[model samples]
Target: MTPYQRWTLRTDATSYTVRLSADGPWAELDAWGPHGVETGPSALDWSHRTHFFTPADAAPAEYLPYGLRPFTGADLVASRPGEERGVWWEFAGAEEDEGALRLAFTDEVLGLRTVLCYRTVPGTDVILRWTEFTSSRELRLERLDSAAVTVPVTGPARLTYLTGQWSQEFQHTRLDLSRGTFSMGSTQGAPGHAYAPWLAVQDGENGPAYGVALEWPGNWHLTAQAEPGGFVRVRAGRVPHEGAVYLTPGETLTTPRLACAFSAEGLDGLSRVWHRYERHLSGERLRRPRKVLYNSWEATAFDVDAAGQLELAKTAADIGAELFVVDDGWFTGRADDTGGLGDWYPDPAAFPDGFGRFVDDVRALGLDFGLWIEPEAVSPGSELYAEHPDWVYRIEDRPARLVRNQLLLDLGRTDVQDFVIGTLDRLLTEYDISYLKWDMNRPPTERSRPGAGPADRLDLDAQHVAGYLHVLDHLRSAHPHVTVEGCAGGGARVDHATLARTDVLWPSDNTAPLDRLAIQYGFLHAHAPHVMSSWVTDAPGVFDPRSRSLAFRFVNAMCGVLGIGADLRHWDADQRAEAARWIARYKDVRDVVHLGEARLLGSPRDVTCGVQYDGADGRTVVAALSTGPLDGAPLVPGRPARLRLRGLDAAATYRDADSGAAYSGAHLLHYGLPFAWSAAHDAELVVLTRE
Candidate 1:
């Protein structure tokens, strides 16, 4: 008889434990929470309960197959070609190395071995979990989840997740689950704007929050089920194709990493845990400050020409922009979005005096040059598409569908991946470019590879994801100096995997002040500010029609990595001077805004909303805005709306940088920062130094 054995994985502030009971063959979660949670009695233990189903079905399993966990949903579902569909696996062995633990299980009848993997992230409350499957014989996996997390909730579970449409991405949503299941996912090839691959769960408003995020960039799903036996189980992983993914002999299939976090201080604290983990993912790249860039997409659109772009670059440089990007229309045949996507060379008609000369001219203005490229897409009218018609995805007998007048190149193919890599490499080599805006304007439509086999056709999503990642990996290694900004028609392909590769992410295309505030408010809950690339655009109103001042726009953009997308050529002397001043002010506080701990003050729903950043070096920066009409009567006759500060040294005193007024930290934390709104002073950028 195998005696009960347990293993504990710990981070600085949290602990996760797994145990194999002497009476059961599967591993189960013992405890998961604050640092000392493993020492207490597990709330998940179901050993004493009487059950009609198998013991493993009712237990808080780490990872169980369909046969053993027939009643409850299984983390893995597999079968042989002509055999039954379930895995009745037995315990094989266990291995532990430095902070990671691996538990192996084998189904001899199916000739398969499965290993559950766990490793605690250093200096964070996040534990990375995944599963590996190896088959001695060929097998089909209908469902292969990365990990199943058992939340320690005694009653109903409140789930907080992110969901929305394209321009309105990252809207926060909440649901309460007492029974049944709740699921969210994306089938749009990339992690679509409809739903993010993340979820946070807690028992009540004040309970500890448990969060999980999948590191997959392709089709994925996250499901939370409040079982009848009184516990919430969250299963997260990449969603397989129409049928199943084939696992041949000796070829191991490893699922994407699932990062699980526990925070006793609720969802806000859980966000900080995710932020630290993201910073760790960034490695040395986080050390470099995200530069202020001016993208010409909004200014000129497809009417891009060397002369016009040069004029914009001059104004951008004058306003203290560090990088100038030519967005779209630069390449040959691309007078508009319909014609020249695949042809990446600069248009001779637009440049007149060579693309190299144009790049040099932009750089001569003391700003680094950047270019936008949508490598995964090709216009039907493009030369590359006309040459390699077979490269784009299509069904043999069906008419090829075009989205945005373009077809998605079959990036899953090695030849297609090589072509993209070559295009980027050659462009980077020829031009003195320091930044690349990699954008995917649309998802793949009619996704199919004509000549592939029955089983191989289903693997298109995974293959494309692998191929996309390979291109990014090559870019990182080949051109380490170049900063890569990831965008998928704005924030569609955002995930841990993409975040690890790109320097920053463009959260949304709608830069209107109020709409962007709400979008960013939701975005900051799951992402770090450093990676959120926000722009100041001349969008009169994309979602909200309310007119906002230049200061309001600057303050809104200042909450993240700042950029200017508005046409600078049209700006008068006063507007340009104000913008230059705002740019200089942003440079002053960007370090604290990017590197500091971010706290979402009052939400966008509140009349007064803001974001506060507390730096490790004793500096605090806050970007406050009045979301509602300033002409409305005050809530209190004589009192100003206050944003109570958080994460401060209550004993110390903080002095305002603008007004030179000093206030005790206790008062700031309790009484909050005061703001009186008007048309001209609807937003404020406050820098506080602790004394």
Candidate 2:
């Protein structure tokens, strides 16, 4: 009754087709994107052709099979209970169910079965793939991949992916596709701060790009290999255990789903596909109004008390902040990082009369209250840790390693999970808290478990991620009104996995605007601006230290969700006035900047550059920043710094919100407006609304 089959799967912009070889097994399928041509059906005979299961002379044309296939890019590799040979899957059947197509393969010798599932969204060119395995007899799997896809392209293809370390995550890198295997993966318990589980492949710099992203949050791998016949194979999955998983009779396992998309419209277009998919899933929250919040870390440090906080709150409220977050050091015995973790209670010294009156006062001042918490760590000096030393990951004889003077609490334990959930629940229920900044400051190390064998230790990494998600999910469900921002010593845990649950991400701990520009630029490439919370902090930059103007800082921070981490109590009267003006300006265009599609023009390395946000309804805003000309190159004699505006109707006219200057869309897109810089480190925000 279904029109789709094993032969073809089609979308509005692309089509995928496969046909059976003479022996009834599928051949290498042909994929057609907007830029690629379609291929004819298979014509090979079974007379002398090699089968993947047979001891073959070449790699199987079908999706990478394990045994006799010469292909190294395999999706499934396993053996039976008493056998030494690899799995040899035989073609069973293919059928369509609802909106999905399933291809089943079986091995009577090993009594193992696999189903290759595929589905295409109704209007998009994305293809979703995953694998399911079932066994009639006990089987052992050494390697199992979630999905494997092959793309037809010759030499000169380039691969692009994101890589960085703590405080500097999401830096984009591109490398030419070489002959051998190039993989980006992490085995350090998490998707890790080093590499993100996403990649894009293209023939060259410009157009016709293919993108792939793995949905798993635990340790994972993605490999792209250049095959012999001008084709490339990509496979992604949870890191397969070299030690094996024994599946009992009647048992079944399903791998994580992989999402793939293709666009002939270049990298930006490919990015748009991902953006659309995320926005569709997030719905209203993706477009919700973000607040201008003031975080009190840089202002007060660990010397926190009710009276001091109240004073800072008054100044923050006076300057038009809608949210006030009291970052670390609000809890029990908390003089420094080494003492008060794991004990999640209001410090008696910091809040002598309890936090109730302070919360009421903050509410009376017309600002929502937020709190910072690192729920997954413990300090050895804390009362809670002293009470429950077994709650953290540790080995029998090894000294527990500490980073940031804290140990990772094994949330994988039910008792630890309950305690975390209970603490967060009580906090949210007892206070007028409107936001929570959930932070994890250190990576997983010393990953051994007491009384557990080696096999169980191998699973510790996955259990930690599972436990973290469970806590996050439970808290969000119980307290739907509160917004949660994710931070891991700043930006280490910023990925789609955490982004899906949290309302915002602290992009970095270093918010000095000059450094923030590049950090934010790299972040926006894979993440939307709405979830990237960039703050205007007082700290000097990591790289540049020329004392940038406050206006430049404000413009750069406004490119994402705006937060102020400055000590407002110390700001001069003139500084306070300028701050108020910029805050007002940000409020006016918050919708466009938060919900609109962002376009970064020129490189962040360029001296004069801009970030533009184009709203769906024809409104636009451009924040142009200049730190002198590029390499001190003199300005053109008659041409100003021209920015060719994008995403405007060529036939329409627009008026500037401030200057009331009129310009045709054609003129703006062609000749561009003359952006004049008065001095070094100068910045200006330009607003244009179509008429």
Candidate 3:
């Protein structure tokens, strides 16, 4: 009798156990949840067998290839030119070191070695999982997923994911899964606004939540299937180019890390697990306080001039902006989106006094200078494109498709990567630029490399991702002083890989107060607030037309890294004064807001919704908002809307910073902090300090 082998990986608050069945070579999930789950009966016990299905197919597999998981979805699908499209592998060995573990399997006939790797993030309940494949023979990998997670669910699986379009990005969507499969992915070169590379699952409405997030920045997919044997499995990884990727002999292909998290406290608690892991990814960089920025896009647009920008810089400085960013139109030939994209040089006409002089002048106003650039795109009429027409993605005979009035450069090529690095290095070296807002306005429409071989074409996506990361890595190492803000139209390129490289992320282009509130509500669920770069703009409400005051806008943006895109030059004296006050207030509580334990109080759907941050010093800051009108009626007559705060010390007494009012923590937790809603005041910033 072959004894079943078991291994358990433990994090700060969670545990994941994997077992190799005596009946087969495959690994099955024994338990995944709170720390003590492994001590209980196995979640994947053999009792729940399915008819007409192989034991390997019905079992909660940790990771399996096509031959083993024949009936179910496979994590890896590979084949040689004339060989069978399945793997019949046997367990080679397993290695454990510190908090990392690796299980190896090999197919002797194919000379392929597959390693499943797992590493527990220190100080976080997150287990990072990925697979590495090395083969002696060349093969085509149709599907290579990073990790497949088998979540134990008692009832129907409830799924929650993020999905939206350009300006409407980060909308939280939910679905229940009793059976069948649900899939979401991005074929675009980026992690598209259509769907984020993240998913959260639960057993039922009240069960513990499990989450999986892929770290890939390029095209990726996440699929969840509720099997007939009463179990849910999720597979996530980078989406291969076209439908397959080529693996050369002796070359190893490592999939992106998939972060798997569990929280017995629910989805909101699961969010904190993600947040802590992100902060861990930030390392020492998280200590640097994100600046309050002022962008001149809405004010100047393409009509940029030195004097006008200098004037705006002075106003921005007066309003307490630490950074002044010249967004778009600062570069040569960039009068509109149609041209000047590939031209990285500053426009001589717009900056008649010289670009360096303009940057110096902005710095003279006591504000750090920042510039926006889309390095991966090109305009047909631009000099760079004309000089090297073969640089963009296109087949030899097919016409290059245009998106956002521009073409995407084939970043997979080394020459293109060098150009991007050189262009950015020149800009940062020449000027005293402290920030770079890296924007990708469009996805690759015709993603193909001319004259490339079939194998090369299949490797395009992976190479492009590597090249993109290379440029970002160069910026980090070559110029560490510069703060990189990641943007893709609006949150299109957001993922752990991008977030690990960038200092901040622009959530959306739509800054309309109510619309932004909903976006932030969803954004905070999967991402930490410290990385969310939200802006306050004067744009009219697109999703919700109900007008909100400037205070509301400031409070909404203050939920993350606050930036002002509204034209300060057009503001009246009172508005400027109010803006200055809000800016000052944000600065006072910024540390707590950025580093504190964040909790979503009431949801955006509620009449009174807010974000609460509890600081280490026992100071709590709440950005409360009134989502709907209070003119007609109230839910309960003679009662104001209240937000019951969480994570409060029940016996502590707290005092408001501004109102000078005091209340008990027990009272606030049970009855909540009350809000008197009115048309004039639809939002309020409450700062409470424990006494």
lDDT of 3 at 391: 94
Tally clashing residue pairs in candidate 3: 0
Q: Residues 1-691, candidate 3: write the lDDT tens digits.
A: 2447888999999999888875567778889988888997787786745588787788788889988778889899888856889988999989988788898999888778999999999899999999999999998888899999988777789999999998899898999999999999998888998898989999898789999999998989999999877889999999877788777899998999999999998988998888888888777889999999999999999888898988999998998999999999988898888999989999888888889998998998999999999999999999999999999988777887788899999888999999999999999999999999999998887777867776444577888899999999999899999999999998899999999999999888989988899899999999999999988888998988779888899999999999999888889999999999999999999999989999998787888899999999889999999887755233666577888999898999999999999999999999999887777778899999999
Question: What tens-digit string does per-residue lDDT give for candidate 2 at 1-691?
Answer: 1222336677667766554443334445545465234554322112333445342223324454567454465566788756775767667888875447788888888888888888876656677778888999888876677787666665756888888777566777888875777888887556767887888888767757888888766678898887555556788888732345567789897776787788777676676666655555455676567899999999999888999888888888888889999999999878988889988888888888889878888889999999999999899998888999888888788899999999999877778899999999999999999899999887677766676555532456556777888998987789878889988787767556677778888877888777777777766666677887988878897776656778888999998888999988878998888888999999999888877777776656766778788886778998887765433233765445766776678999988989999899999889776676655437888999899
Candidate 1 per-residue lDDT over residues 1-691, each given as its tens digit:
3546889998998888899965567898889987787886788876556467877777788888898888889988899987889998888888999889999999999999999999988888889999999999999898999999898677789999998888989998989899999999988888999999999999976788999999999999999999877889999999865557888899899999999998888888888888888888889999998889999999999999989999999999999999999998888898777899999989899989999999999999999999999999999988998899999988888899888889999899999999999999999999999999999988877788776777353588899999999999999999999999999999898899999999999888788888898889888888888999999988977677898899999999999999999989899999999999999999999989988998888788888989999998888999999987776334755567888999888999999999999989999999999988876788999999999
Model 1 ranges off by over 4 Å: 1-3, 455-458
Worst 10 contiguous positions by lDDT, candidate 3: 630-639
Judging by TM-score, tell me the better candidate of 2 and 3: 3
lDDT of model 1 at position 234? 94
**What TM-score against the true fold does each predicted structure earn?**
0.98, 0.91, 0.98
Residue 128's lDDT within candidate 2 is 77
Which 10 residues in a row give candidate 1 its minimum summed lDDT? 631-640
Tell me the spans in candidate 3 whose CA falls farther than 4 Å from its real position.
455-457, 636-638
